[model samples]
Target: MPRTDTASRVITAPLDRVWDALVDPAALAVWLPPAGMTGRFERFDARPGGSYRLVLTYADASGAPGKATADSDIVEARFVDIVPGVRVVQAVDFVSDDPANAGTMTMTWQVTAVAAGTRVDIVATDVPDGITAEDHAEGLASSLANLAAHTER
Candidate 1:
């Protein structure tokens, strides 16, 4: 079966707050990066057909990151769909020299209102062969945790 890594969590924030984090570049910059990495948007246009660029760099000098040996990862992404307060879909391509990592991937973020809070779901499809599923999942989880911590305060 084709690889699709998925994760879900219930955030204490409301749907609007969660949605704001998805669309607001400033909020995203705070929580989108994984544990040790940090993210900054090169260019972000949230509308459909708009393209975005993000650079994820290591927080520490150590080269090994879970499963890959790279100081950073740069992705060129396009917004496929955006439903405010509901869903977002992005088509992304990583800039890499390796043949295994040269491919387009899709990432979907969904937000649903739950009893306790908002349920956030992320699904990544067509993940690069250079990145293992476990690593990707960890990164996603870390981002979610960051988001949770960010809005909670």
Candidate 2:
């Protein structure tokens, strides 16, 4: 069975700024991690049928210095729906090198504009067997915080 996890956060920034930070590679690298972590996008295409790949490096939760990795090279991302500055729905699939979990998964990012800022919701389904929902939740929260900071600045 495929497990699903959802995470959300509200940022005090304009919708356009939030959207730009989400799609731009350079801007994404700046706000995609916690204080001690950093990320870089290898390939990113904002439109549908495009591919997206990013590398995230961070110290373990125990404060130990180590590299954490996540890759999605075979992603067939498509913009399912868009409402200009209001909202966006995207479908993402993961490609893994491990033979044990070679299947693809789908993730949806839903953004809503609010009076104070923007509300972002991410629902990822079909997570591989070894990955835990709690860990993914923590990571998504950290990334959203970083994103909020980046957009505010």
Candidate 3:
């Protein structure tokens, strides 16, 4: 069986603003990587059947160069479902030579208006065996944190 993970966070921004940030390609480059990393989007099309690609690189805690061996991860994804200001679902697969990580995963992002702000829920399914549940959860939460900070600014 494939692994599955779910995480949610509340961004201090309005639903519409968050939605725009999430769907925009340039905006995604600003806040998509997890802690201690940076991201660059090569292509991003936010409509159903459209696709996107991104590169994420790792750095040290001191923000200095060196130390980490696994320098980057490449992700290619497709937008499967998109509901303006409401939800975005995607199918993802990593570009890797390792057979252990070979597989496609589906992630659903739900955005809803809340009293405090906008609630963002993430659900990922069919995760490859190489990715642990805990690690994937942290990555998801970290991404939400990044989004919150970006939208709040």
What's the CA RMSD for each of the models?
2.2, 4.0, 3.3
TM-score of each: 0.93, 0.75, 0.90
Q: lDDT tens digits, residues 33-140, model 1?
A: 888888889899999999888888887747554222457778889999999889999998988777777788899999999998999999999888877888788889
Ranked by lDDT from best down, the candidates are: 1, 3, 2
Q: Order of all candidates by TM-score, from best down to worst?
A: 1, 3, 2
The candidate, 2 or 3, that scores higher on TM-score is 3
Report the C-alpha lDDT of model 2 over 10-68, residue by residue, as the tens digit: 89988889988776778877886545566666777766555666655554435432322
For residue 45, model 2's alpha carbon misses the true position, in angstroms, by 2.0
Score candidate 3 by TM-score against the native: 0.90
Error of 3 at 132 (Å): 1.1
Clashing residue pairs in candidate 1, if any? none
Winning candidate number (lDDT): 1
Query: Residue 18, candidate 3: how far off, in angstroms?
Result: 0.6
lDDT of 3 by residue, 40-141 (tens): 988888899999988888765344221122577788899999999889999999887776677999999999999999999999999987777887888888
What stretches of model 3 exceed 4 Å from their correct place?
60-69
